[model samples]
Each structure stands twice: as C-alpha cells, then as structure tokens.
Target: MPTSICKACARLMKEKEDFPRGNFDSDYCASCVDHKGNLKPRDIIRVNMIRYRVNNTGVSEEEAAEIVDNLMRSLPAWNKPKTPTT
Candidate 1:
C-alpha cells in the first residue's frame, strides 16, 4: 500500500487507513476535518482552530472575541487582493 500526504498538514497517510475523498486522495487527514464532522475550507479550519483554542482556555468572552478577531487578521483574509472573474 502507498502512503499519501495530507493536503493541509503534510502528514503522511497510509492507503488502508486513509479514506480518500473528493478527486482521488487529495483529501485531508481525519484530524484535519472540521469539528462538525465534515470537510471545510482550509482558512475556515485555521480560524476555527484558533477560536477553539481560545474557548478552551479560561478566558473572558470579550477578551476571547478580541483575540480571535486579531488572529483572523493575522491570516489577512481581508487584505488579499480580489480576483476578477471572467
């Protein structure tokens, strides 16, 4: 059996253990899937992971929200230039 790499984390995957989905084994690892038990865009996963970390810690709601906002800004989703569609 061949090993495949996770598109997100670059973790090695084994064929028997790996469940490939969406265009033949370009799938993310089980650990990389969304908390809701489904696939999500990479940016969403990145954002949610940070938010989940913030929530897990004993932080105040207002502080956590602020932190998460800053975290998202660090990813610069809004800073990227827009692409023109044909």
Candidate 2:
C-alpha cells in the first residue's frame, strides 16, 4: 500500500496518527501535530455539535431530554444542578 500523505500539508501519515481521522485526512504535518495536537477547542465543540445533531436523528424529544439529563449527571460538581422546591 502507498504511504498516505496528509492532504493539508503534504506530509506522510503514520499509523495511529492525525486527527479528524475518518474519511478525510488533514493537511497538517507531524511537526504541526506536535505543535498543535488533534482538534482545537472550537473544532472539538463543532464536532460535538455535529455528533449531537446526528444522535438526535430519529430520537424523540423525551429521549433527547433524557440524554441531556444523563450527560448532566455525569458532569463534575462545578456545574450546579437545579434543586427541587416544595
């Protein structure tokens, strides 16, 4: 097999390397990977947003709400939860 190169920066891609590792490879170099690992924060948020939308596909509102609830439950205490009142 031919050594697949990064389309972005034209560098050789090694096994278990690079980010956004799905169908499309990046143009970043190995040095760039070292300098700036995987996805940026904004990019990560964007990807998560895309994933969230994709996961919502065919899911009901109640199911989506439950998913959000579960995610909230798993978060750290820095995030405050709403308390129930009498």
Candidate 3:
C-alpha cells in the first residue's frame, strides 16, 4: 500500500479509510473533511486537533493549542492564503 500525508492535518494516509470518501486523490484526510468531502474550516480543524491531543495524550489544553497552532501553520493547506469565493 502507498502512503501519503494529509495536507491539512499531516496525518499519514496508508489505506482507503484514511482518505476522504476513500479518495486516494484527496490531499486531505477523512478527519479533515466533511461527509460531503469538503475541507473543513481551519478553526474547526484546529479545535479538533487540540481536543484530540488533550484527550489522547493527556496534554494541557494550552499546550495542545500551542502545538496544534504551530503544526497547522506549517501545513500546506493552512499556510496558503484563501481565495475569495465568487
């Protein structure tokens, strides 16, 4: 199996379940997209990451937020400027 990193969350995608709607072409991951396969808002992604870190790793909320913020800033999706919708 091939592996790819999610542009939004930096999660390793190794199987169909890792990609949004099992889309191997998707740059993001299932956790980074909605059920309709649209990329979620940055704030929502940030919150989800922070929450996951805090709950799963027993990290402080502030620390998790800091880590998640830095991580998100480094990701391709979050680093790029958003274009206005027509």
What is the TM-score of each predicted model, taking all chains together?
Answer: 0.34, 0.26, 0.87
Clashes of each: 0, 2, 0
What digit string (tens of lDDT, one per residue) describes model 2 on residues 1-86? 22455422333556544433332345443433343445233334333434554576766556655654554343322125633312
Distance from true position, residue 68, model 3, in Å?
A: 0.4
| Candidate 1 vs 2: which has more TM-score | 1
> lDDT values of the candidates?
0.53, 0.41, 0.88
Cα lDDT of model 2 overall?
Answer: 0.41
Report each candidate's C-alpha RMSD, comma-separated, in the order given. Answer: 8.1, 13.8, 5.0
Candidate 3 lDDT: 0.88
Cα deviation in Å at residue 81, candidate 2?
Answer: 11
Clash pairs for candidate 2: 8-27, 9-27
Minimal lDDT window, size 10, model 3: 77-86
Candidate 2 regions with alpha-carbon error over 4 angstroms: 1-55, 77-86
Span of 10 residues, lowest total lDDT, candidate 2: 77-86
Per TM-score, what order, best first? 3, 1, 2
lDDT of 1 by residue, 3-83 (tens): 566544444677554444432354565656654546666667555555665778867656766765665444422225532
**Leading candidate by TM-score:** 3
